[model samples]
Target: MNRNDTPNGSPAAPQASFSLRQLSDADWARFGAGEIAYLRPVTVNGVHAIAIHGADGAPIGAAPNAELAVAAILQHEMAPVLLH
Candidate 1:
């Protein structure tokens, strides 16, 4: 089963994507700005690395491996997603 699946093979309920309590257009634009981050594979100075960026495409950090990349993202309370 996938991450959104239940033991019985049913899909789980969807989680909230953004807050309804947002106060303005700016708030909507930054709905997941800090909560979700993307992991992109990159070559830094001829070395393989993972670059982490916020949902808005701003750089946050990087790591030599995916494990460390994920750990760093989680430590910052953000969800990590792999980019294709």
Candidate 2:
């Protein structure tokens, strides 16, 4: 009975280990420089906090909340990325 379970009752595979703190300042400078790709998004609540998942059919990272999650995935803190 995992939350990630699908309609057919199969479980989803785990995502990759990309962390926000792991990225250097320079990494932010070069994010999404070349091409464009689609990234799936998911939002979940933890015992003490809310989080967003980078589920581009795969996990890129998780954020403390929807706003930060969108920012991390989109690589920007612009107004359009806000979860409204």
Candidate 3:
């Protein structure tokens, strides 16, 4: 049987899902003002890295670990959130 199919041939329940929502005008404004940042775990050259992204979805910086990444973002007066 296919991975997505149950024993009886019915489709299996989804394991996980998410919805993307567009940012509001005020959100964009805050981003432009450097008030927000997002920290996402990433892999670089086969090594783990933390990628910092601006609210506008642009890459801001990266760090070798989450602690350093959060410190960097806070030092710049921006909020950091982990993306999983």
Best by TM-score: 1
Candidate with more favorable, higher TM-score: 1 or 3: 1
TM-score of structure candidate 1: 0.64
Rank ordering of all candidates by lDDT, starting from the highest: 1, 3, 2
Q: Write the per-residue lDDT of candidate 2 for residues 1-84, one digit (tens) a residue.
A: 678987778997786688878888667545543322223344455333233322122234455555555556556432222222
Clash list (residue pairs), candidate 2: 40-56
The residue-by-residue lDDT of candidate 1 on 1-84, one tens digit each, is 999999998999999886787568676558689899899999988999999988878798999999999999999999999996
What's the C-alpha lDDT at position 47 in model 1?
97
lDDT string for model 3 (1-84, tens) is: 998999999999997564325767676556545777888999988999999988778898999999999999999988788888
Residue runs of model 3 more than 4 Å from their true location after superposition: 1-33
Clash-forming residue pairs, model 1: none
**Which parts of model 2 are misplaced by more than 4 Å?**
1-56, 76-84
Compare the candidates by lDDT and give the number of the best one. Answer: 1
Error of 1 at 64 (Å): 0.5
Q: What lDDT score belongs to each candidate, Candidate 1 first? A: 0.90, 0.45, 0.84
Candidate 3's C-alpha lDDT? 0.84
